[model samples]
Target: MNLLNMDAENRVVLNVGGIRHETYKATLKKIPATRLSRLTEALANYDPVLNEYFFDRHPGVFAQVLNYYRTGKLHYPTDVCGPLFEEELEFWGLDANQVEPCCWMTYTQGRGKFGRVSVTRRGAHVTATYGDMPGAHRFEWVNPNS
Candidate 1:
């Protein structure tokens, strides 16, 4: 149904980056000034084949963003890269500060003539150490520019 005639309690189907999500219209309208809220308001009619509003976005990240709307809590997902997650949150008009501390960790091991470099993270902080050089280390985060 079109938004003009949609029921307040009706569930809306969203095909977000090929992933399907069914949420209450009221829930989707909870956050004003957000893309989701604007999308809900712009729902002129549902697609015939998909029968949902289609949006081009990373489906994986959208799941976490959806949860924020559903629960009023935001958790940085470990599966998604921090930089990418931050960009998605920005697009969704979400505050990055809502993220819980140390909610994610990433690891990268590099091996070469220099032996090996091990890197790990706790939230935005990253600690790196080299196997060849004793006590060799450095710390960094995803959003260095910001």
Candidate 2:
């Protein structure tokens, strides 16, 4: 079994999903995998707040993004997802064909831009807002200087 010491504010683990991934800084881990799953399932099932943040989005994409926060990496960027997956490729409705792909990043995070990727649920499309920009979104794919 994997060991996770979540005995403090920020929990840390030496392995996850048997992947053995490490974190930049070790945290006091407390929540075990089962507890984490229970919490996640409960949050996903009952959190209207999260729904407002990403309501009507694909479950898979939402899960992927959530996984990013957990693992500190985003495996599915627009460029990556575009070439790797076609429309109707993923079980969730996170189609890379809906719009352009985009990527962005902050100081702590590394860069892997993939352009703007958007998807529609019913009649409206998930959009991003930038100050006076035509469409400022999260996945804008800003290339970092080498």
User: Deviation in angstroms for 120 in model 1?
Assistant: 24
Best by TM-score: 1
> Which 10 consecutive residues of model 1 have the lowest summed lDDT?
104-113
lDDT of each: 0.70, 0.33
Write down the RMSD of all candidates, one decimal each: 11.2, 17.0
Candidate 1 achieves a global lDDT of 0.70
Give the Cα error of residue 47 in candidate 1, in Å.
Answer: 3.1
Q: Against the hidden true structure, what lDDT does model 2 obtain?
A: 0.33
lDDT of 1 by residue, 72-105 (tens): 7777766665567777889889877776554523
Off by over 4 Å in 2: 1-54, 77-146
Error of 2 at 146 (Å): 53
Candidate 2, residue 48: how far the Cα is off, in Å: 6.9
Scanning candidate 2 in windows of ten residues, the lowest lDDT window is: 104-113
